[model samples]
Target: MPCDACATAAGDPTGAEFLTTKSRLLRLLAPLLAAALVAACSTRAPLPAAPPAATPAPAPAPTGPLTGQPAPNKSRWVPVAWSELPGFDADALHEAWNAWLRSCERPAPAFVPLCGDVRRLSIASGEEQRAWMVERLQPYRVESLEGTSDGLLTGYFEPFLEAARQPGNGFDVPLYRPPADLTTRRPWYTRQQIDTLPEARAQLAGRAIAWVRDPVAALVLHIQGSGRLAVREADGSTRLVRVAFAGTNDQPYKSVGRWLLDQGLVRDATWPGISAWTQANPQRVQEMLWANPRYVFFREEPLDALDAAFGPRGAQGVPLTPGRSIAVDRLSIPYGTPVWLASSGPTAQLSRLVLAQDTGSAIVGAVRADYFTGWGEQAGDVAGRLKQNLRLWALWPK
Candidate 1:
């Protein structure tokens, strides 16, 4: 006999009709089969019963916030009340509005709808903006899968260096653009190889965009990945341009600071410490620089009055807002996400909003971040010394 529930579930509507037909046929054959039924049952064996239906497995529980959204590939987002976010109410939202507005220029898919509200609130008061955030966003305490919340926070900045259009007059350290055959060469050339090898030199022969006087400063530019250059053109007039990261030689970034530490040459590996050592041992500067095999190429960009206000474009493809832009691991927290950062260390105490507008090779893990401190010497000073503990909260759409 057909199972009515199973038949209906399978979308076959003839189960009930088949049952009625079987009843009529049974009534018609009842008298004729009465005597033979007992004999037939005694002679024949019973048919095997149908196998039981398999049960479906249950779905896995959500690993993200209550909203049921999945966490980023490298981190989990545990939903928390806004009140739990330390100093959320105390932070001046207007200061971070510029970074939020910049994020709108290339908003992520999840944040696309919120950009309009973000723009409107740009002119609003801090208290009003805070209130708006409370209503529109959900705060998630960022953590690793192992439930670790504390992470390292470092800083980076744009350097300002003087350069020459041509290599002469003591401006001999060349910064190059990506070579024409850059793609053809896998892990093209190490920093030491590029400096000493003729074949490597030939590949980058005419690719120098500008040349600076100090090799140390050029190394700084390479590590920072970008900088502002006051370039002296062939006409002797100076023009300010930005050198942005183009490509690398595909070598690993072995830290010169780590090299110094491992060699027991210095206890401090900050830029200031490195500079002091380089000045003392000028002859060994090349040896110190070659400690790191990686090399970065750059492309020159025009720095107009409007562009001067912002830092060089970050990994997110947007101009970074100093003090308000942070580089995070894209696998942990995506670009363009607004974050509430809180840290208290020897260098500085920070409790404010920042946008995840950039990324760095070293800025990995669930809660790690590199804070952008803007440009020039002072900014560089802050960036060099900023290594501290950090905690982060991601403010996502409700």
Candidate 2:
């Protein structure tokens, strides 16, 4: 889990947790939907492991989650307040997106996510830059979801969540599950790019919660988020090092384990790396890397900077477990509320803590949140590299 960084000074930009199991949707998932829709993601790092369940929605509800005990009358959530929401800049966004697509055509760096087959992109309403998504995401079109919220995530919206869970299209691609699926194609991505971090590779490959469509995409996304970018320091937060990118916990924990080894903080306890090392270690591989809990993915600035000041770049620590380290909007799901999360998307290999902490950005709805990834290049590589489906549910209070 991320070290203690005061939760974005509550009310500034909201922070939320999506601690749900791998099952049907839950009340808690409603918040997740909101964040996915409106959260202005800066940069991110790698994700951690799964967590215990959280929430109070039964899937079989004939009508919906309503009719059950009434949840507290919390404040209504509004993504990017009318005032904060900047005018839609379709042109700018499109330009950047296409550039990203172009970048994919060439050989990517070691820690980037490949977009070899980014099929049609349909970033309808609720998406920040529709024009940008549309212009850059050519061939595909953008839809406006003005008066109606009926897609997969529609019902999860505040007013809608109370009535019943809507059966809208899940994630960005509804009627578009590729046959063979993207995860099955690793060759299309950049493999064995980080020759010096075999330990990190094995740790991440076996350690994270499998999510990337290809290794290249994962590496590209990670590198892009942190590499050669202007660092934006939070005001008066010089001591704090804001970690822009954290990778997705899309792979197995074993991958994470090897990463620790490459860092020289820990030995190859998992044996797989040792096994690989025995046959033939990758060139430029580091055998002196180390890792520890204190160096886990951190969200707070000072701590992230502190770790980066001494830790490895383009690498990350562990993530926050869902149920264990989550914080939520008391109004939406009580402080100790456990919820089930089920949104019809791919998989959401998130961070160690799916905190329901407050956020101060555009996504401050009762049903929204911010994901805190650790700082630096590694974090950026992972955070920017992820794009998948998610479903959440919070369990009842223990």
Candidate 3:
């Protein structure tokens, strides 16, 4: 719901005006990023308590037939020829190169030696870039243990919300930092427990980072793991800051979207549909939120025009590249690995090279992935709508 500027320019990194107004306008139009937030939030629901951790299988080497080290989970990898990669020639390699460079910020051991070559290729043409990949990297098609080549691919993004320094004028819901005892506890309070239990509330009393108008907005921030806050300062001026994932309460995540679907409360479990339900059932907002037991804590950081164009750092410890970064199950595909992705849905017919830079709780399957759709409404729209069939080829150092 951000102004046309926020919606139109979020995907374009060069939009100086977009970056300037992004934080301020984003809070006003929560719709801009709401969809991605929903996707990410819903996906973060804890997996049914995982059984005891199994001994990880050794990972395969950079070569060989579909045989080698096993991925941590049930994911499998099969070596594939570059010719098998769909639309390999059509993608903008430079765009993916940006993500690759970001990944180099904390390059994997195999990738560390190739950093110089990667830097030189920055100025190379698309064809040249492709040649570099073909010459230096091996492509391995990822699969599920069931031998299926396909799996689910969803999307998520960094959200921006409006807030007040103090709780008043409808801004009553609090965004809190982690409690002093968060790390010491096995599992902390549930969402419902935190809302109604006096002890839980007291522990978080002085930890409020900011206050928002809607409890749902606070919930969105919790699920997405990070977001930007447009804060109304005491002097009546607006200041922008980013809240990052500091820790979680160690409670299992539950999918509220699935909960609503199971309860037959909503026909479509998308953010818009969920929002409508929340509005119509204001009395039951707490019930809807309590459906998920997990809670996230945050730490705030500064946000400026330069930083506004990028997203929060991913598991790879690098700023995410919009349109060219993805969150993969780290155990299946190591972080910093480059990947060839082919997924077509209502939002886009994507055949692109992306970096495995992040991870999500829901992105568990070997072939599963969560696309980082950038920030703002436009990114959210694509991410929210993008639950598509996926094929992946990991591009590793030869």
Candidate 4:
């Protein structure tokens, strides 16, 4: 009996009406009602449970210049065991080449295969490469592939023909791999022998450097990107900039890691001694080795061979034969392509054709190379100890 007029005095009434009615009913019921109150008022439906935080992406595994799941058949392709030319005969290769050419109207796989090697046509001089360039361009087209196009077959080669000059290492050299082999069917350098190094010994801790630019794949781009390190200066500044490669205990390379190490100038460790160190520092190996260039392989013959677990280059069988790995210009040379190589000088040092089984990020152009470190710690140690001279040639039927 407080009245219907009191319902208007009760407030805005939607929710309040519920309260008022309950209060009135409770009053009428006297002390029988239990206590109650609006727990969560002003209302809308409770929010849907927030989706569980999305699972974090897994951290990528540690690797050097390789990414995703790897090539899948990465280990399946072994260096061409050309002792007796292995499985495919020269005739069989010819048939395959001819068949592909007939069907595709382009250079066959012999010209390129997954990680294969092709004979690099030797241009005696920049003049020669230029002459070929003219024929392709017709003087009217001042076309330059540099910084544009794949560059592997054209632009990348010009720099070598003009600058590096294969058989010409500074003064005169007979120690280039293909040159030595072409002249003698053996590499110019070998584990048992190193050719008459026309190039002088690495002065003090000096190393050499080369460039692989605007590569085709992001995998390579990421490596070159990461491989790059800023050279800091004293007083928190840096002056010079360079892309370095590992030098050979036998040759010269200048990767940032190598440059740092060379500046440190390690002299005591022979191949065997380095192996012991990698074993002890197994935990932070790449970090330890990256900080020290003495353990990064750029070129030169590895003391042992390649182990897939490590890098590339090594000896594999019981008969005591050489195992090898290399990187080549995928544009000029295809993967799985077999190459016959030769070098110069008096010794059968680096003279033999091996399968171009492996590839690397910075490894570009027809003349480029990366020797694999063999299996296990020894291979890793030996691979870390390379850097050398080079020459390249592709194998083909005369």
Candidate 5:
């Protein structure tokens, strides 16, 4: 994800800082102007004063323990009462504490002082946590400059699959580490090139970290960006390891599901639907896979018992909490900001607090977000089908 300086340098224009400086200048000049006006009244002969300029009424200060702040470019924060948060009272606040604690690991400067309170409240009751939140933070309804509050929400999950230490016993498809010349090459190779070109294959010759049985499973792992692989070792034992996102091929990510839909091959574009289509049209599998040009490489990490309990580290550099972590556009919401998310759709009805912990190339917009469902088949099922309307409220420091 881009840093604040990078985002600024990337040419996002916002006048909030300039306006703030102008306001300070006006305040400083007010006293001098007033004194000059008094001197003119005494020194000059009585002259008719010009009609006073009509002053625009000041916007009402927000009430009910709510305050406002300027959001990032293309967005604004509307201060809202805690009562306005849907289902705020009913949500299981403790379930979100784990995510909140993770945010504390790399807390934003404004939130640094609150991390101690957040950690102490981990063991506190839900009601207690809620009370502390009400006292310390202000909920701002996140909206675009046009005041559109509704947006889209999707879901993603970690995948767990079987693998072999080497390419054998039906584990023919290989998952690779980044090629040695990855940094030097602007885009090493396209997915189609990597599969068909001898030179591309030579580049990845010895880069395989593990081999999986099915190409479809490998595709899922690539799309998800990371996965837990249960690798069969040489000694007839299995070891679980995490294959994390190392880098991409630098090509654009085109959805194979979208390609299938456009070709009239499948009505459902979810993973299950795509799998069914592939099974039925085995001959065209390569064609379907090549619909996307991007390829992701991975690096293996030991998944110890303690590490297994949490999801992979997000862009925020902290382990994600399933069901409570969300990937957001950094330009819309900075990482570590607590967000109140509400969405109702076929797959799930959710009204809960989530953290802006991670980011995806696809997750871009003032209100858009991608919810993180956990790992395994059930999570995948939900993630595959979760496309719904969303509303968000950022819980910011007062």
Candidate 6:
């Protein structure tokens, strides 16, 4: 979600101290704390059931040549022929080429001269384009400084949700735009402070862009950094808008998914697992959200059929291509560089060319990558379940 003016860095925060989860006692004492709290629990409806995990694509057999051996440095270039790239010949190169075009929109200087070549080959046959790539780029395998060639690959996507133009009925939680005085305060406010403190609430009071019924809806939007909102306009028509990353409160971004894992409440720390835990522990939803101190702010973007076809702009300032765009550690793979990704995850065996078009909070390490799984529920299922072994090859200027 680090796009245009938004730059998000990863942070690991210790979980907040948990108080008792005794709902019966809390309900009895609720009247005394009425000013600061609502009833501990009510009959809350569940969110839509998460889509089933995608069936893993069969692993393609490796027929390509291997590097002579691992590079000695944390990341080293091993001379690899184009034949060494698994599934290289089979991919829809035109699709990847589209991602490459977006990469060139704010391309690194090293790639500027090659932009024209990319455009010219956009209409070429896949093989011709593959040939063009082999002629122009050198492929180097990436690894850790320790010489470990393997790393992790996960997925992320743009989520869509129902929202309201005004807060009422069950849609009471607000999604806010950045406050005008945001810059004046350092580490402006924690999630708990924002929810409970008067001054902290005052800063964001008038900046809501939309509202949702469940706090988790807003939380997921915050985590994803961007999402499509189906807004119920005052006149009863629905208009879709995107909430792209605006800025953050400068506090550390924490993972509630990870928090759920450490508490042993869930075995797999995926979106579905998080949802299941939230469903069972509705009374503690506020505490679960407050586990992360960092908060996100967003601004609206147009979401037409065309815009919805692509994803939010990445760090490269271009809309991301699903399955062909990746967020990498720029120090290891410069922006706009093409990469040969070989991964065998729970959902698929992915071996293809991807553009280093973005970066993310959790995407660290030279070999680490977050695969853009695209938009919507099915993509989300793949993204949630995908944490697999990954190897990378940077296709750079020869």
User: What lDDT tens digits, residue by residue, belong to model 2 across residues 3-45?
Assistant: 1121221211111111111223333333333332222222232
TM-score, structure 6 vs. true: 0.81
lDDT of 4 at 343: 27
* lDDT, model 6, position 197: 94
lDDT of 2 at 74: 43
- The residue-by-residue lDDT of candidate 1 on 120-181, one tens digit each, is 98899987898788777777889998999998777776777778999889889999999888
Candidate 5: residue 362 Cα off by (Å):
0.8
Which digits, one per residue and each the tens of the lDDT, describe model 4 over residues 1-398?
A: 00110111111011110011123333432222111011111011111222221333223223232221232221111211122221212121221221122212223333333112212213134334323322221111001223221112100000000112121223121111122122342222321123223342322113322222111111111121112112222353422222222322222122322332454533334323333444554564334323312112232321111111122121110111112234454554444433433222221123333444434434544454443322222222223333333444333211
Instruction: For residues 1-398, write the lDDT of model 5, one tens digit per residue.
Output: 21110111111111111111123433533443344223222211211222221332223336443224345775677887777777777777887888899899898777888999999999999879988988888788999889999998877767767778888888899999999898999877999999999999999999999998777677767777887777788887667688888888888777777788899998876555776777789999999888878888988998865566677888999987778888888888888999998888776778888999988777778998877776655556566667778999988887
- Clash pairs (backbone) in predicted model 5: none
TM of each candidate vs. truth = 0.82, 0.23, 0.82, 0.26, 0.83, 0.81
lDDT of 6 at 46: 14
lDDT of 1: 0.72
Return the clash pairs for model 6, or none: 56-347, 74-144, 74-145
Model 6 shows how many backbone clashes? 3
| Local lDDT at 316 for model 6 | 76
Which portions of model 5 miss their true places by more than 4 Å? 1-70
Model 4, runs deviating above 4 Å: 1-256, 259-324, 343-348
